[model samples]
Every structure is written in C-alpha cells, then in structure tokens.
Target: MTKAKRTAKKLHHIDRAMSETAAAERQSGPMRVLAAVNELSDQPPLIALSAATLAAGLVLRRPALTRGGARMLASHLLATAIKTAVKRSVDRTRPHSVDDGYDYRLEKGGSRSHHYSSFPSGHTAGAVAVARAAARTWPAHAPAAAVSATAVGAMQLPIGKHYAGDVIAGALIGYAAEAAVGAIEAAVLPAMTRRSAS
Candidate 1:
C-alpha cells in the first residue's frame, strides 16, 4: 500500500479502538447511574420546578435573580437550538444503538427512537446556561448554582444516553451562550433605556 493509504488505515484502526473503549465505558455500573440521572434531569416535574423558581424570583422582584432568570432562559433556549443543529449535522449515535450486547435500562415512557443523536446533551446545556447566568448575576449565589449544575451533569452518565465528554461539551456551550447573551444585554439594554427616557 502507498504511504497515504497506510496512514488512512492507521486512522481507521484508531477510530475503531476509540469506539470500543467508549462502548466498554458505557457498560460500567457508574455510567449506568449517570444515565439514570440524566433521564431524571429530563423529568417534567423537575423542569416545572425550575420554571417555577424563575417565576417566583421575577414575581418577588429579587434583583439577583429577576434579570438573571430572563437572560438565562433566553441563553438556554439559544444553546438548545444550536445543540440540536450540531447533533443533526454530526449524527452521533447514542450508547443504546451501539450494540444489543450492552443492557440499557431506558426510562419508561421516554421516546423509543434509538436514533436520538447524543453529541451534546440538551439538558446539561440548559442547566449549565442557567447556572452560569445565575452565578454572574448573583455572585453570592454562585456556589449554589454551581453545585446544582454539577449535580445535574453527573446524572447523565449511567443512563447510557451520553458520554462524559458529551456533558462537558454541553456545559461549555451553555456557559458561552450565557456570556454572549449577557454581553448583548449589557451593551444594548442601557442604550434602549436612555433612548426611551429622552
């Protein structure tokens, strides 16, 4: 084989090895717990609780959380859209689709589609976005928000929906989104307020 062909073959072997390693990791007991937690993170009741907390902060006019809630919500939504687009483009397979040899305790009532792309977890992205925004808006609450984000992220491991790398990528995306939104708000909102006051 030519030198270029040899290099290509080597790369292919590396790819296969990486896939096998990932499969093994997913079958681990701790990973299964992470997957279960990830499924719980998507529960409707938990989501509702988060929404209610945001609403309560706004209704009560808690300066720390009112603006943070609005901005975080916007950033999280934007991150979700971006994540969805990237997942579609890359089309990474979830752990459950890799093989029938691996057992998956899938959450009941969850969508049956095995094709759900798992490049970046939407739940982790949203949670991280909200946590970052909250931390920035209320420095005093940063520790709590950080803890919540970490807990939510840890839950994604065992359910076999996403790998450790997926959660980390999702978190980075969310934090970037939150920062971008915060920058825009800082730059634009004051100007709009001043213009309206004139």
Candidate 2:
C-alpha cells in the first residue's frame, strides 16, 4: 500500500477503537439507567398502567380515551399471543443458554414452557405494542414513546435474555399487532357509530 493509504487505514482503526471505548463507557453510565426502565416492560407493571388508564377514561367519560386504554391492553394481548406461537414454532434457545453452537430446545406441554421461548422476546414485544397504541392515541408524544419502546427492547441484550435478532423480531411482531388492531378499529368503529346514530 502507498504511504498515504497506510496512514488513512491507521486513522480508521484509531477512530473505530475510540468509538468502541466511548460506547463501553456510555453503557456503564447512562445505559445502566435503562435497566430500571426495562423492568416496566414486565406484565404486572404494564397491566397496572393499563388499569389506571382505563379507570381514568371511565371516570372522565372520554370514549376515545377509554378506547385507547382498551387498545393498549388489546395490543399487548395480541403481541403476547404472537410471541408465544412464534417462540414455540421457532424453538430457539436464549443466548445465555447456548454452548458450542449446539444449544436447542422445543417448547413442550404448552405456553408456559420456557424451554424454547427465547428466539423472540415476549417482554420486548409487549412493550412496543403498548407504546404503539399510545402513539396512535396521542400523536404528540410519539417520539418519546418510541424511544422508550426501543430502549426496552434493546435492554434484552445487556440482560442476556435475548439475542439481537430476537429483539428485532419482537419489535416487528409488536408493530404488526398494533397495525392489525388499527385496521380493525378503522373498519368497525365507523359502522358502529353510524348504526348508533340511526
């Protein structure tokens, strides 16, 4: 290689090393905070939030808000169902469980089995579903909600709960579930309202 080409290659390696080092530091600092937020992706906390939203909608007499709450809950349900089926059918093991590139397990008995549920993360899927529903209901806060959802899904990596591919799969499933819900609402709600008006 020419002298100038050699210098350029050296600079590229140096820049790559710096970026990796900076990433490590960031993960140890602010990224650790994300761990706490990731816990909210769990079912209990999500259900609590849904219950509160539902109660507020009912007490305030906002049909749209109530429907939003219902949609959030339903989206989560849809994500859960899809993740469960996908996990079973895929039958892939978690990253932490693999060894010698030969790790494998099949989900047996039913949905409760943990043997092969790690290919796509269920928690990440539910988190994204809730966020998507919220975004549809409140357009103003879409950016913040989307960031939160992405963080929750990506957290599965540091937690060793899922592979990167699993996280992507979960997010896609969540998005699709919300889209399905939106389509159904668009088709059915207008007809219901028109019938009620008559």
Candidate 3:
C-alpha cells in the first residue's frame, strides 16, 4: 500500500479505538455513580438556587451576597447562551446518537438539547463557572473549588453526555466567563462605590 493509504488505515483504527472506549465507559457498572453526579450537576436546580439566593440577598439587604448571586446568575446565562449558539452552528450529534458503528453526521436545526447539542457540556460549564467564581472570591479555598470543578468534568465522560474535547471546550468557555466577569467587576465596582460614597 502507498504511504497515504497506510496512514489513513492507522487513523481509522485509532478513531475506532477511541469510540469503543467511550462506549465501554458508559456501560461500566462500576462507574454508574457518574450518571448520578451528572444529573446533580445539571443547570436547572443550580440556577433555581442561585435565583433564591439573589432574592434573599435583596430582601435581607446584603450587598455582598447580592453581588455574588448576581455574578453566579450571570455566569450561568453566559455559558448557556454560548453553548446554545455553538451547538446550533456546529450541529454535532450526541455520541449515543452517533455510535452506530458507522460514521458521524452534522445535521441542521440543533434546537433539541438532549440529542443535538452535545458539543459543549452545559452542565460542566455551569459547574466550572460556579466553582471558578467561588475560587476567585475565596482564594484560600481555590484548591477545593478546583476539585469540585474537576469532579463535575469527570462525570461527563462515563455519563456519555460529551466527549473529552467537548468537556474541554465547555471548560474554556466557563473559565473565560469567570475572567470576563471579574474584569468587568474590577473596573466597574470601584467606580460605582466611589459614586455612592460621594
């Protein structure tokens, strides 16, 4: 065989190996807890809690809590918005949908979240955003925050919600949101404080 043909054969074998590994992980009984963890890390419950915190902070006149709540909500929104747009454009199908022992396809109309929007794990993004914000606010507990974020990421693989690349991309978006929001706060908060004081 020619060199190009040999290289293509090897690449095809590697792709099959990776797909098989991902499928086996989802079926492993020993790692079933990952499914539960994935469910817990979902966006709805977390967002509801954040909303409650925001309401409580406002009612109790707690500025710091209010700010934290606002930031948390903003981070969730940012991650979701980006995730949705990218999923719509990329149109990548879920692994379970694609694992037919065949090829992959990028379909149109990626509005169906459970099926099509699998490129970036929204759950992972939300978890990382919350963890990152907590880490930034309490620098001393950054290690624990990191562990929490990593655990959220770990659940995605065995749960079969996303590929490793998807998780990494989601994490990038999550961390970027944290950095962006922090910069905005650093620049705007001082100005707002000064005006209030005056």
The TM-score leader among the candidates is: 3
Runs of candidate 2 with Cα error greater than 4 angstroms are: 1-37, 99-115
Model 1, runs deviating above 4 Å: 1-36, 43-50, 101-116
**Tens-place lDDT digits, model 2, residues 134-190:** 999999989988998888876777654565667788999999998999899999999
Model 3 regions lying over 4 Å from their true place: 1-20, 28-32, 59-62, 100-103, 106-113
Q: Estimate each model's TM-score.
A: 0.69, 0.75, 0.80
Q: Of models 1 and 3, which has the larger TM-score?
A: 3
Question: For model 1, what is the error of residue 31's alpha carbon versus the real structure, in angstroms, after optimal superposition?
Answer: 7.0
lDDT to native, each model? 0.68, 0.74, 0.73
**RMSD in angstroms, all models?**
6.2, 8.6, 4.2
Instruction: Output the TM-score of candidate 1.
Output: 0.69
Clash-forming residue pairs, model 2 = none
Error of 1 at 193 (Å): 3.1
Model 3 local distance difference test score: 0.73
Model 3, range 151-179, lDDT digits (tens) per residue?
88766766566666677778988888877
